[model samples]
Target chain A: MNANSKTENRALASTVLELDVNNHAGVMSHVVGMFSRRAYNVEGIVCMPVGYEKNGLKSSGETSSEISRIWLLVNEDARLEQMIKQIEKLEDVLSLRRHGAEHEVFERLEEFFH
Target chain B: MAANSISNQKEMFMTSKRSEILTGAQIVVRLLERQGVRLLSGIPGGAILPIYDALSQSTQIHHVLARHEQGAGFIAQGIARASGEVAVCMASSGPGATNLLTAIADAKLDSIPLVAITGQVPKSMIGTDAFQEVDTYGLTIPITKHNFLVGSAEELLEVIPHAFRLAASGRPGPVLVDIPKDVQNQSIEVSDWPAPGASDPAPAPDAVLISRAAAMINGAARPILYLGGGVVHSGASGSAVALAEKAGLPSVMTLMALGAMPVDHPLSLGMLGMHGARCTNLALDECDLLIAVGARFDDRATGKVAAFCSQAKIIHIDIDPSELDKIKTAHVGIAGDVKAVLGQLVPQVEAILRKPWLARVADLKATHPLRMPGIDDPRMPYGLIRAVADCLDDEATISTDVGQHQMWVAQAYPLRRPRQWLTSGGLGTMGFGLPAAIGAALAEPQRTVVCFTGDGSILMNVQEFATAAEEVANVKVVLMNNASLGLVFQQQTMFYGERIFASKFRGMPDFIKVAEGFGWQTLDLDNAGDPSSALRAALSLPGPVLIHASIDRHEQVLPMVAPGAANKDMIGG
Candidate 1:
């Protein structure tokens, strides 16, 4: 591994952020760009369309679902509060929930990466 | 029977009008008209031709054709800053879109309300390096409050209104809407017209936090009101001034909040931070409580963040929650509309005369006031600004391009009203003054607009002179010629061992001749027997005019706070 990976490995205390966002072509960029621009590294990201249901009613569209859920694994740092505040400011981010490092979402996929 | 049938037909017509087929371009124009956009600025090019063609038929909206895309963007910014309204700018793909990025970024940093609409290449042609093609949506994402890429004509209805809403909402900033050429050309039937987008009501101030903040204000011995651009953005200048007066608190304005409190007010400490008056910085240094209202602790406003207001407990109030503790952690952070918060918090606080503190501030003012070396000489920088101020009243708007001239005006000019001063504070854009002045003039035709520009800064967007002349905008371009980038030269003189590299221009353009060439009336103060009279005469002219004055390049903006230095430590004024 490179020096960067070593640095990441040293920062063992991590947090998983679950974000519900509007499904669109540019939503991913808005979500990921926030981390990249601030130089905050994302350890892993998994995203998939949840459904077209909004306000408990299915959106009538043949093209695709209206919303998606994004999971982000990032190192816990002092700037995380500020980072979350900035992300929450984006127009598409519906809600954000923080999970502890023990969350199994990233752990279950770790074997596949190896 | 005929009257009854006519009434029934009218009812049928009203119902049919609710749903109609419109091209994306038409929808965009109609939505803007509904949003009360009477005027917009842009330049037409290949990618945006469809929108332009549709806009040409608009009876309700008038488009000002700018010489450059950046000029158009700044023009929009000028309108927004001057009126505290969400303004719009349009540009084509690629270079046109790229050119607008600077102004958009400037708007973002300053929290100015602007909607930038750009044309993109057809959806299918995107990422193929087609002619005049660029990823405008991608480029603007980092700069804007929010951005949209419209996939269909149907999306235009939702996107356009949302863009306005986002631009004008709490903690206002620029928003971008990139419409593909095909999308603009596409036809779609719209059923229900969305209501014109407006700012959502600000979250109510936390009553507990408000009470705490008020208690802190009432209890503090030496409290200072720190105002920023957000004050102007929130339309809370009156409330801010009232708060200062009622509590007998000394107030200091950031560069973007120059006219929040009249500089001549007894409690007004002109500006705080780098290049601020010695008295202002000294007062801030000694302040026991820093009541920051709608003011982010910008590095310029608070030199060396760790050292800034070190003695003070901060009570920070802003509409944006993210800004509350982002810089200096506030002891009492209140996130709400400043106007509303002040409205409630004002009555709760016990009004007392802070006599000793005011006396101390007054003593500081008397001993360490802002020094203007040649304030009476019209040829000098400070004097030139003063002379111009002498000629115009508070009704005349003042804008300046970035450099030494900007600092001088900010320091010396006696601005008394909100929305009376416009400058590129956050981005420090060089070419902002002229076009912004034009936009201000266009927005409020009755007001005389004056733009103070330096030799180095004017050349950046000099092409806007033609637009000013064509529109017959009542603008006087006060060109302060120093033949060098004065700020850079000053920095090099101070820190870089006086080794000036590209800061000095080898050959200077005769700005008087250039202005004349651009169909502007020119007045050379260098040639005039009485520079003051010449300025008055030039300013009195109805159409676009240029008044030029020459200054020594060595003159510097002063009482300088060296970068990263504490505010208390300063150089000569």
Candidate 2:
């Protein structure tokens, strides 16, 4: 059985959905609102624009990597699989990757903060 | 200082070819008219004055001045729900934008297509928290389908179309656009307006999954087709019935899908879940296969998720890919449009008459008939709903507020067509009735619109009564005055050892007087010697009318499965 299979296990584990979306004003709302509307909980979220932008040197249309990377930490239930599929369908989302509980992006952040 | 940022952003973002030079407010007005927006509802303030000034010059759009921002949003929802088209509402900064939150959340929960436009403080003042300034984009982020904070006039041109497209497209919901005041004042050149993108057609169903679902249907001895709101949104009621009839399968409707299948149909299991018929819940428990079509297994519908349809080998089909296998892992998951998928699957499966299974279903239904308390007495809420249902045509749309009255309507109202029944199912929002009814009435001017509201729910958005009267909307407010938050009171009674504190309203306002104050024709059901005559007279009134119904506080929504209990473990008769 695949590790993601619901049949083999019902054990709850946290999963992260990493998404790259077009950097824009409304994109994050679409990502966050879908979860809230469905009553699904997001344990942690980290998002930031890719490439250099602190100096305001690049125009919005000119930058090739005008993309924002979003990491959503959620319980790896059957619902997460479906949520990932929906997130992929969003027009602004360019690509997505699902990481199992072993992924330590949020944990690493915690360690850095400490 | 706030105005400088808008100018700075405008200079940086003038990439589009300049064809015409006009103020940002004028562009907004022109864009709305070009997009075929005939009606809008809002209350203008200092930040939005320029837009309103431009709006006043236009003859194409009629703006309704709502008493509250929430009323405006719900009115837009009503229009969208009734018309199956995008609707718009507007508000200014701070409290005005905050007031619209409840309605926006309601729209999000029920998947209503709405676009809310809010005016913000000048861009520099956004973070500074100037007078009447609030971060509308931040506040509404969790409640909207998408939200835009327009930085410049050029951005406003792009954001408006995107807002409409996002609001109307795929599993539709509310979207918001927050415009800085200076952005609306500054002149910008625009070549042409981008048209809102049309909704993309649902992807074709997988051939392999279709066959798998067909095989499951053919093999199962007892199968049930569970339908929800997505079926209605996709206009797939005919296909839903076709599949059910072809396979000789019983069907169950959720609160949002009450009218997807006609209640009088022979194989219909009226509704399933907390307030569901006992037979329907039992049928679900016994079902060998649960073919969930456009139906998310919501907690209210599923009771305890693990025990719900435990025996069923599920075949889930939905337009939204996310809905499939979300709650219950399906044996065969087909991610496609309900209509197209049903069209593909119905022909592949052979028709079978499951005589024994259907007979058992009939027996269960007979054994646990839906009993009403004093149903013959018009004084009861149940009787009032029955009386109203009798008077209204099938074409009439019924919008309801959340509470005991909403549940009573779900149980007793024989909704005949999809889109005719509008209720806040997912969000369960109170105070949604009057404003939604106004939108519904305006959307379908020829058809009658009725709002079923409770004493507690009406108080949440009582300000909407003025809007209903001012618009002269073809709506009737059937206020079931139980003098308490009936559902909360019921829950407290059952689970909290009858400890009712905040739920009761000892000195509720006279609904008749309130309706009269709002310029509506009023009818008091309690005082009328012949209530049927009074009801008929109220229905015949030319303008907005309020039928004040006096009901007992003891009346409860029956057949309620306790929290986290199995569907079969219902408490009331």
In model 2, what lDDT does residue B471 have?
87
Q: Best by DockQ, which number?
A: 1
lDDT of 2 by residue, B1-573 (tens): 679988877766765444788888888888888779999899999888889999999999999899999899989988888888889999999998999999999888888889999999988787896999997988887778777788777776777877888787777889888888998998977788877544666668898999999999999999999998888988899999999999999999999899899987898998899999899999999999999988889999999999999999999987777777777888998888888888889998889999999999999989987777767667787788888888878999999999999999999888989999989899888988889999889878998999999999999899888888888999998999888999989999999999998999888798888889989899999899999889989988987999998888888899899989999888877
In Å, residue A26's CA in model 2 sits off its true spot by 6.7
True contacts kept of each: 0.57, 0.38
Instruction: Give per-residue CA lDDT, model 2, range A25-49, as digits (tens).
Output: 6688778877887889998899988
Instruction: Tell me how far the alpha carbon of residue B473 in candidate 2 is from the true structure, in angstroms, after superposition.
Output: 0.9
Pairs of residues at least 3 apart in sequence or in different chains that clash in candidate 2: none
After the best TM-score superposition of candidate 1, give how far the Cα of residue B244 lies from its true spot, in angstroms: 0.3
**What does DockQ come to for candidate 1?**
0.50
Q: Kindly give the number of clashing pairs for every candidate.
A: 0, 0
Q: Tell me the spans in candidate 1 whose CA falls farther than 4 Å from its real position.
A: A1-10, A55-62, B1-18
Q: TM-score of every model?
A: 0.97, 0.89
